[model samples]
Target: MKLHAGSNILLNLLVAVAVSLVVNFSYLLLLLVDQKNDPAPPPPPEEVLRKAERLQCGALHVSPDGHGYLLYSGGDSIYVPMQRIRRLGLRDGDSLVAEVSVTHVPLAHPVMGKVLRRNGAEFDYGSLFKRPAESVVLTLQLIYYVLISFILLSILTPVRFRYSRRRFIVRCVWCLVAAAGLYFVALVTEWRTGRLVFNFMTPRMLDYVLLLKCSFAVVVSMLYGWVYVLIMQQQAVAMENEQLKNEYLTTRYNMLVGQINPHFFFNSLNSLSMLVREKHHDKALTYIDQLSYTFRYIIQNGQNTLIPLGEELDFIQAYGYLFKIRYADKLFFDVDVPEEFRTWLLPALSLQPLVGNAVKHNAITTVRPLHIAIRVRDGYLEVANPKAPKLETEPSTGIGLENLRSRVHLITGREIVVVDTDTEFIVRVPLQNPAL
Candidate 1:
C-alpha cells in the first residue's frame, strides 16, 4: 500500500525509536559484561535522573470507555487512562503532560552488573501524565521533518527542472556513489572509535549496498510523486486553453453566418413589391435569382475559414444586383478587382458585411442617387459609397460594422477603417497576407 504524509511520518518516527532502543540496549549489554567481574559504578546521579524530562513517546491506544495509552520513557512503563473523554472529543496527534521519578540499582553480579545495574523503578503513571514532555518531543520532531522536507524539495525539485531520462539515471548513480563514500567514512570512524553511526550496515560492501538501495528507493518514490503532480497541472492548463479557443472560433463562425439583418430582408422584399407593381416581371425574376445566390454563398462559406477572393467577389456581384433592384436609377454599384488579386485568400463573408452596413445606414431614392464602389488598390481592398443621410425609419444599429471589425482583426493583423470625406463613406481593408 502507498504511504501518505501522516503514515510516512509515523513510520519514520517508529524506525528512529527502534534504532535508538537497539543502541541503548547494546550499550547496556556491554556495561553488564564489564561489570561481570569488576565492581559496578554507582547508580546515575539523583540530580541527573530527576532532571531528565519524562517524554511520553507512543501511539495513543484508545479504549472503549474513553481513551488510554501505553506510555514509555527510559526504562519506565505505565498506562495512562482517560475515562471521561469521548472519541469525538479528542483529536489525532494530541499529547498529554507528565512528570516521573525513579531509583536506580547497581549489581556486582556478572552480566547484571553492566546491564541490569542501570535499571530504575517505575514511577506513578498519574504523576507522569500530569506533566509529560510528549508535546515538546512531538514539536521538535515536526520541526525536524519540515526542515528535511524543505531541504529535499529545494535541492531535488530544481534538479528535476534540469531533468530528463538521461539526467535521472545519472543522478541515481551519483546518489549511489555518495552513499558508498558515506558508508566508507562511517566504517573508518567506527574502526577507530568502536561506535556505529545510525547502524546503517555491518562492515561489508553488500550490507552498505542494501542500505543505500533502501534509502534511494524512498527518495525516488517521493520525487516521482512530486513530478507527476506538476505534469498533471501543466496538462490541465493546456487543455483548458484549447477548449477556450475552440469555443471562441465556433461562436464567431455562427455569428458571421447566421446574422443577415431582418431589416435588409424586409427592405429587399419591399423593393420586389414595387418592381412587381410596376409589371417588370423579367427584372423581378432576375432579382429573386440574385437574392438566392447571395444567401446560398453565405451559407456555404459558413463552414470554411477562408475562400478565394474571386469567389467572394462573385457573391458580392449577385448582392449588388439586389441593391440595384431596390434603388433603381438612384444607386450605382461598381467592382474593379484585378485578375491577379482574384486568387488571394480572404475570410469568408468579409465583404458582404461591409456592403450590408452601407446599405443599412445610408438612404437611396430616385431623387438622391447613391454610388457604391469596390476596388483592389495598392495592397488593399477599398469599399467606398456616397454618404447619404439616414432615412427616418431606417434601422440604426451598427452591430454589423462592429462584428466585421472584430472578425477582420481575428483573421488578420489588420482592422477595417472607415473614412468620411464630406460626401463619401470609405472603408479600407489591407490585403491579408496568405502566409498568416
Candidate 2:
C-alpha cells in the first residue's frame, strides 16, 4: 500500500536518525580503541600545572555577577576566582578538554585543582596533533551521518523503477559509482582535517572498511526507494486502467447513439414521402423544414454524452412536428417539465428513442389518438405513452430500449426505470445536475 506523504517523511527521518546513531556509535567505539593503543604522556610538574590552571586552559565563562569564572568540563563545571586567573583567552561555550590534579588535600581556593593537560578548539596540524574532545567529535560525526543519510534518501526515493533488465543493471552500477564517489569525498575531507573519522584500521584494511560502509548505506537507500517506487507504479497502473475503461464506455455510447441517427433518418424520409404523394406540397415543404431542423439538432449534439433538458426538449418539439404533420390530429405530445428543472442535464438523444418506440408499437387513429407525455417529477424526467400496440407491425429488435438504458447508466450512473402496464408504458429517466 502507498504511504501518506506525512508518514513517508516521518519514516525517512527515522531511518536517517537510526543510521546516524549507528555510525556515530561505531566511531565512538573505534575512538576508544585508538585511545587505548596510543596512550597520553606523563603529567607535567606541579608548579607548571598550577600556572596552567591559573591561565584558564579550558573554556571559561564569567559568572552572571562578573565576580568569578565557570570552567566547563565534559560533564562538570568548575568555579574559579576571577582575580587569580590570568592570560585567559577562552570564550563562552567554546569546546575544550583539560586534565586537573587528583589532590589529597582540601583546597581553600575556588580552583578545583591545578590544570595538568589542556586542549583547545583550534585545529592542530603538527606531527603530534591534538584532537578535539570526544563530545565535539561525536557530535560532528552524528551531524555528518544524518546529513548524508537525508541526502541519499531524497536523491533515491523518488526514482521510478523501469521494468528492464538492462536498466536495472545500469541503476545498480550507478548507485555503486555514487557511493564510491561520496566515500572518496569523505576520505579527502577527513585527510585534509587530519582527523581519523572512522574505525582505527590499518592503512591496508581501511579501504575495505570504507567500501563496506558506503555499500551498506547505498543498498539501504536503494531498498527504501524501490519500495516507494513499487507503490507509486501500482497507483499509476490503476489510474491507466480506469481511463481506458471510461474511454471504452464513451465509445460504446457513441455507437449506440450512432444507431439512433440512421434509424431516425429513414423514418423521417418515409413520412416526408407520404406527405409529398398526398398532394400536400405546402405541408410537405414545411415537413422538410422541420426535418432539417431536427436533423441539425441531432448532428450538432450527436457526439455529446449529455445535454441540457431544455435543449433536448427543443429538439423533441422539432421531431414531434414532423410526426404531427404526418398524423394530423391523431398524434400529440404533452410536455409539462418545469422551468426550474430545465437546466438539469440528461443523456443526449434519450427522449427521442422512447417517443419513436411508442409510435412504432402503437396504433394511431382519429378515434384512438396516441398521447405521449413528457414531464418532471421526483427528480425524474418521465416519458409516458398510452398503450395501443398494433397486432400487425414490424418485428421489434429491442435495440433502442437497450441502447437508452446503457447510455443513461453510463453517463449519469443511474438506470432508466421502465414501467409497462395494460393502459400505459412509462420510462422514468433520472435527472442529472451538470454543475454538481
Candidate 3:
C-alpha cells in the first residue's frame, strides 16, 4: 500500500537537479518589460549618410566636471553628455569614434551624438554596460529554478498517500503558478539591460523563451508525477505475484505432508507385519522407529521453504534406512558432503522426489544392488545413481520430478540440472551460498 517516494531525499534531489539542467531561464527578457534605457535604434541609410558629415573620430577626454569631449588630431573637440558617460561607464583616454550635432548654445562645441565605435569595437549603449556573461546568467538561473523545483516537490510531492486526479491537477496548477511568478523575477532581473535592478517601468513583449520555460515546467511536473506512480504500481504488482506464488507452494507442500504414497505405506506396513509375525521383535521395533522418524521429518519440513543442507541430509539418511530394511543388502547409499558446505541452504524435501524416482524405476537385487550416491560439487548437491532397468518398468507420470523442479524454480528462482544417460542418472540441485 506504500505509494510515494517523496520521502526519498536522494530521488527528490536528483529530480530537482535534472529539472534545473533542463529548464531555460535566459529567455526572461522576452517575457517581462524593461525600461527603454538602451540607445535609440540606428537611423535609416539616408539619415545615417547625412549624419556622417558631422561624424568625428577622436580620443575621448573626461573633464573634472564629469563631462566628456572627443579630442581630434586637429585639437577640435565636441561635448558628450554626462548621463551617457555615467551609463556606459566612460573613462578618460578612450578612443571615441562618434557622431555629433550642432547646439544653439553660445560658443559651445557640437554635442556628441550616438557613439559609432569605442576602441574600434561597435557597441550599443546597453551592450556597453558590463552585463553578466551568458554562462553566468544560465548558472544563476539554474540555481534559481533548482530551488523552485525542490520547494514545489516538497509541497506537492509526486506520490503521497495515493494518486488522485485532484492532487495531480493541483500539482499542475502549482507548476503554472511558479512559472507565472517568473514574470516578477524577470522584472527585477532585466535580461537585455540591468540584472536584478527591480525596475517596474520596463516593457515586456511576446518571448519564445518565457513560453519555453512555462511549457517545460508543466511538462516536467506531469512526467514526474506519472513516472513516480508507475514505479510504485510496478513494485506493488511484483509483491502480489510473490504472494500468489507462495500460496501455490503452500498448497503443494500441504499435499506433500498430508498424502503419503499409498503403495509405499502398505508395503512398509506389510514388511513390519511380517517381521512381527516371524517373532523378530528387535527388528520390528527398529523398523517402527525408522518409519516414525521418516513421517515426522516429512510432516515437520513440508510447509518449510528451505533448510540447511546438513539437516536435509539427516532426514535423507533416516528416509533411506526405511528402504534398506525392505530391500536388505540390495540398496545402499554413499553420502559424501564437506562440513564447510553443510550450512548452505536447499529447498526443503528436495531429495525426496529424486530418491523416490530412482528406487521406483530401478531394479534392486542381491546381485545388482542399487547404489545411490549423494555428494556436493561446485556449489551443487548432486544425487547420482546407476541406471538399473527392472524386468518390468514402473509406470510413471513424471509429476514427482517435474513438481520438484517447479518448486525449486518458484522458491529459489533457479533450475535443477537433470542428466540421464544409458548407464546413470543424476540430479544437480543448486544451493544458496552460506553466509559468513
Per-candidate local distance difference test = 0.57, 0.72, 0.75
Best by TM-score: 2
2 versus 3: better TM-score goes to: 2
What are the root-mean-square deviations of the candidates from the true structure over C-alphas? 21.8, 11.5, 8.4
Q: TM-scores for all candidates?
A: 0.50, 0.69, 0.57
The digit string of per-residue lDDT tens for model 1 on 87-150 reads 1233333333333322354632111000111124332332323433333433433343333333
Relative to the unseen true structure, what is the C-alpha lDDT of residue 189 in candidate 3, on a scale of 0 to 100?
A: 52
User: Which segments of model 1 are wrong by more than 4 Å?
Assistant: 1-206, 261-264, 365-368, 390-395
Sort order, lDDT high to low: 3, 2, 1
Error of 3 at 369 (Å): 7.3
> Residue 135: error of model 3 in Å?
6.0
Q: Candidate 1 has what TM-score? A: 0.50
User: What lDDT, from 0 to 1, does candidate 2 have?
Assistant: 0.72
